[model samples]
Target: MKVVIVGGGKTMFFLGRNFAAKGYRVVIINRNMEECEDLAKQLKAVVIFGDGSNAGTLEDAGTASADAVLAITPHDQDNLVICQLAVNRFRVPRAIALANDPDNVKVFEKLGIQAFSTTHIVSSLIEQRATFEEITNLMPLGEGKVNITELVIGSGSPVAGKQLKDICLPDNSLIAVIIRNNQSIVPRGPNELHLNDRVVVITLPENHGKVLKMLTGEE
Candidate 1:
């Protein structure tokens, strides 16, 4: 698969190296020609120096045939504009963005941008590891700051049958989505608690245990 990244930062470099090492074609585009040249040389990537939002630049970067486009600039507005161009103008099949602010992630999601805030995600993962030493499949938002955990609610749990609002979630934890019968549901307060439900939760490291007990049968 061909992937294009619109930024030449640490994250971009890491992604390019990993993908290129794994034999995927990668192109890294950046406004700073020096950083672009240095990173491209280090990773053996196809580096393009230009403004990512420009149609000509995108075309020159081979965006037309890219399997995925990632807009990960430090600036949120730039990232959004890049993503919009990739999706709307270039018609890229997949577009992802990097968000500097966690609060902005939801807004991006609402705009149909597949994006995440590295700071928020990483911090939550670190916190999760500190709290739940046994928890695995932590989404690696950071070394341990935030986490995306697949929590299972077994039978006879305290929260079974209780309305979602009644369940005491740690302030740091959020029930982002629920999966039942292979269907994904973005949870709302009106969604009632049910036994044997598997939930995908996003939370800060500190509040994972409380969420675990509520999710699994153990208190």
Candidate 2:
């Protein structure tokens, strides 16, 4: 697999290193000469010093052969343009952009580009941590439309001691796995939830609160 990363500071360097470590062909494009020099020295990726939003720059970075293109420039417009070019012009299979403005996420999606908002993600994480302390991990999927949450079943949890079949989960939600005694168990209809068991639940973002309430007996 080949990946092209456009614009970023530490993120670009680390992503390039990680992709190279995974044996993927990594290409990084940046306008800053100093950063490009640093990245070229530290990472095993092809580092090109140029504005990634430019078509010629992307071409130089081999975007045409990239399996995935990620545009993470600080400017939302630049990110949008880079992603658009990668998908529409280069025909890359996957094009992801970073939306500096939360409102631009939908705009990017409407233009057929996958996008995520760092601002919205950070705020959501803070809110989730404050509201649901039992949630160990919360991962957003489908661009924050769906969430996979890990919840620790407490003694007061309504689903504790109940079989999966009897627990009434909200629509578009299901308990995917149960981790007990350091072992992971694929949940089944006959499987029963126990106190302190860590459960991985997949649910729509709208049903996050309800899933927590049902599983942890918390609002």
Candidate 3:
């Protein structure tokens, strides 16, 4: 996957290094030449020094064929604009914008862009660190009105034999994907579950218990 990032902050460095290590082509954009050079050198990613909100800059950064685009600039408005161009004009398959304020997510989602609420995730993690073994919390999207939780199939799960269509899954939740041998399978309603398969589910936090039970066959 080729990923284009419209930011040069710590987040970009973290993401760039990870994707590059995994053999994906990553390009990071920023207006500051110094930051660009530093980030590029450190992460071994291509750095394009230009305005991230500019369509021309995105074109030069190859947004037209980008597999995914991230609008993670510090300014929320700039991130929104960049995301709009990537999603609406460029039509990148995955257009995610970093939402600094939880309140602003609705506007971005109205434009049909996926958004990340860093504020809520960080806070929730810090608060839950003492209690949960490992937390996979989904941030609110569309608006700051909903949240999702994901859990994987544990060892010896009883749900493995049943097809999704056969199992009476949670009404408020959906089976998102199944991973086997580290390969992701986006789940379909008729998909069959296999033993030892890892699953990632997207469901409201209120429905987490039901989804977990459906996945692990444990209440």
Winner by TM-score: 2
- In model 1, what lDDT does residue 149 have? 87
Better of 2 and 3 by lDDT: 2
- Tens-place lDDT per residue, model 2, 92-204, is 99999999899999998898889999899889878877888789898988878889999899877888899999998988998999999999999899999999999999988
Q: Give the TM-score of candidate 1.
A: 0.66
lDDT scores for all predictions?
0.80, 0.90, 0.76
Candidate 2 residue 167 C-alpha distance from true site, Å = 1.9
lDDT of 3 by residue, 40-135 (tens): 678878789999899999999999899999888889999988988988889899888998888777767777777878886676556433333333
lDDT of 1 at 134: 35
- Error of model 2, residue 195, in angstroms: 1.8
Off by over 4 Å in 3: 131-203, 208-219
- Cα lDDT tens digits for candidate 1, 1-219: 999999877878899999999898998889997897798679878899999988889999999999999998888988888888899988999998888877888899899887888787666557656654334465746534576887666665677777778887878788888778888899888797677677788876577677776666564
Better of 1 and 2 by TM-score: 2
- Quick one: how many clashes does candidate 2 have? 0
Residue 1 in model 2: shift from native, Å? 1.1
